[model samples]
Target chain A: MAEECYTELEQAIQVLVANFYKYVSKHSLVRNKISKSSFRKMLQKELNHMLTDTGNRKAADKLIQNLDANHDGRISFDEYWTLIDCPYMVYPATDLCK
Target chain B: MAEECYTELEQAIQVLVANFYKYVSKHSLVRNKISKSSFRKMLQKELNHMLTDTGNRKAADKLIQNLDANHDGRISFDEYWTLIDCPYMVYPATDLCK
Candidate 1:
C-alpha cells in the first residue's frame, strides 16, 4: 500500500479521507468529526467547483442538514461520503469526468 | 472546472467517480451500474492495494453483500460509495492515509 504502489483510484480515495481529517476538530469531545462550520468551509473550499451553491449560505446549510443523518450537528466520514455520492454534485461537474 | 483548475482534493473525488464508470458493464440491461462480476473485477483491479481480501471470493462476496444496501443485483454509484466509506477497508490501508 505504499504511495508509489497505489493505483490512481486508491490515491483518490486517500485524498478524500485525508481531506476529512484535515478539517476535523482536534479539541472537540468527539474526535475525528468535522464541525458544522468546518463542514461549510469544506464545501466552499474543497467543493466549490462541483457544488455551485457552496458559496450560498442557505444552500450549504441545507446540504449540511441533509448530510448530518444522525442529527449530530457534525459531519462524520460516512456522512461526508454521502455528500460525495450525491449525483447532483457529480453529474454537473463534467470537467471532473473528463 | 477545467482539469487544470481542479484542486488536489477535487481531482481525487473525480478519480473515484470515474473509476466507477470504468468498470460499469456496457452491455448490462441496467446501464451505468457495475454487475456482480464487474464489481469483483473492480475490487481486484482498482482496490487490490486497499482491500487485502479482494482475491478471496467468499470475502469479496460478503463485502459485496454488505455494500449492496438495497439488495439490487447491480452496484450503483451510491452503493459503490458505501464500500468506500467502510472503515475496515480504509483504516487498515495505512499508506492511503499517508
Candidate 2:
C-alpha cells in the first residue's frame, strides 16, 4: 500500500486499527473478538502507560465493563474502539501521562 | 515527557489527541470547538487519504452533519471523536484507503 500519500491523522487512525489486529493475531483461535485474558494482556502491555492502573485487575475489570456492552466478557473491534475513544476524547494525552 | 515508557497503543492515542489540538491551536480564539470551515480544512488536509471524498464540499458537509450533534454547525471534541470513531470502528483503514 502507498502509505506515503496518507496524512498524519489518517495514518494515526490506521496505527490504531492495526494495533488491534496485532494483538488478536498474536492469540490463536480468535479473529473477531478478544477473549477476556487476551484483553487483559493487551491492557497491561499496550495501555500500561495510558492506564497506570492496568496492572490492577479490579480497575481493568471496571474499564471493560462499559466496553463489553453485550456483557459477553469479550471485546469486539467496536468495543475496543469504544474503550479507546472514551478517554481519547475526554483527556489530553499529556495530562494522561502525568 | 518520558515517551520511551509509552507503548505503541498509548502513543497512538496520544497522536490522535494531539492532532485535534494541533489544528485547534492553529486557529486562534477557539479552544473548545472547531468552526465549520476549520473542520472542513481539517478533513481536507488530515483525512484526504482516508476519505477520498474530502475534496467535495457536499461530502465534507455531509460528513460533518452527524458530527455536529447540536446542529450548531461546529464540532466539539465529543462530536469530533464521534465522527472519527464511526468510520474507525466500522472500516479497516486499508480498505478505507482503497
Q: DockQ, in order, for the candidates?
A: 0.73, 0.58
lDDT of 1 by residue, A47-89 (tens): 8777676777777778888889999999888888888877755
Q: Which stretches of candidate 1 lie over 4 Å from their true place?
A: A93-98, B93-98
User: Over 4 Å off in model 2, which ranges?
Assistant: A25-31, A88-98, B25-31, B88-98
Best-performing candidate as measured by DockQ: 1
Q: Candidate 2 on B1-98: residue-level lDDT in tens?
A: 49777776777777778777766634556667888888889987887666666667887787778678899877887787776777633463322222
List lDDT for all candidates, in order: 0.80, 0.71
Instruction: Give me the overall lDDT of model 2.
Output: 0.71
Error of model 2, residue A62, in angstroms: 1.5
Q: In candidate 2, residue B11 scores what lDDT?
A: 73
DockQ of model 2 vs. true complex = 0.58
**lDDT tens string, model 1, B1-98?**
46968777888888988899998889858898889999988888988888776777877777778778889888988888888877755675422222
Clash total of candidate 1: 0
